[model samples]
Target: MTKRSKAFNIKKGDTVKVIAGKDKGAEGKVISVLIDDQRVIVEGVNRVKKHEKVVNQGGGNTGGIVTTEAPIHVSNVMLVDGEGVTRVGFRREEATKTRADGSTYTVQRSVRVSRKTGKDI
Candidate 1:
């Protein structure tokens, strides 16, 4: 059997804010996560320009400079919650229990709370 890999609480569609680098304070939704590289591509962070050459296609076409966001290390991003502040790890109230046909499934929740106010975040 293949061993399961460590679970990263962050998901692809999560909102995050850049805490470091040239794009500091920029916020965007997560596009993709690279677990192996520990990187994430935000909607508008670490933008880099790419020069493209026009390829001859029978029809009219053009190629020029395109700006795209490059993946930044996950450590550089902080998950932003409803309050729009950086999150600090905290314990959840309890595991959600689901029962179907007498089978129970307990889903563990990871809560991110405010580091400053000590409230749910």
Candidate 2:
């Protein structure tokens, strides 16, 4: 059996929909990607509470629960566009020759879009 490399098609800023966890079906922007771990942290998904202690100069530290987002497995999410359609692959545009002006310009590239907006960021 061939070992599959841990790689995520999702990128930073890519809008993703959580397919699992407590935030299932929730959509948010990708805040960061942990390629090595095959995990990505969405803007508002997989929230985990962290207990923190406040150290005082005079006495001991006070502990409390701090709510924050946690890293989710990339496989549990899907990339979505403004039309709410999921994306499968990365879209890249190559420079092509134009006849009229003969100048190089970027064309409309098909990339993943945010489900909230049809515009690619």
How much does candidate 1 score in TM-score? 0.64
Give per-residue CA lDDT, model 1, range 40-60, as digits (tens): 999988999988788788864
User: What are the runs in model 2 whose C-alpha is more than 4 Å off?
Assistant: 1-5, 55-63, 91-93, 96-121
Q: Pick the candidate with the highest lDDT.
A: 1
Clashing residue pairs in candidate 1 (N, C-alpha, C atoms within 3 angstroms): none
Cα lDDT, model 1, residue 36: 73
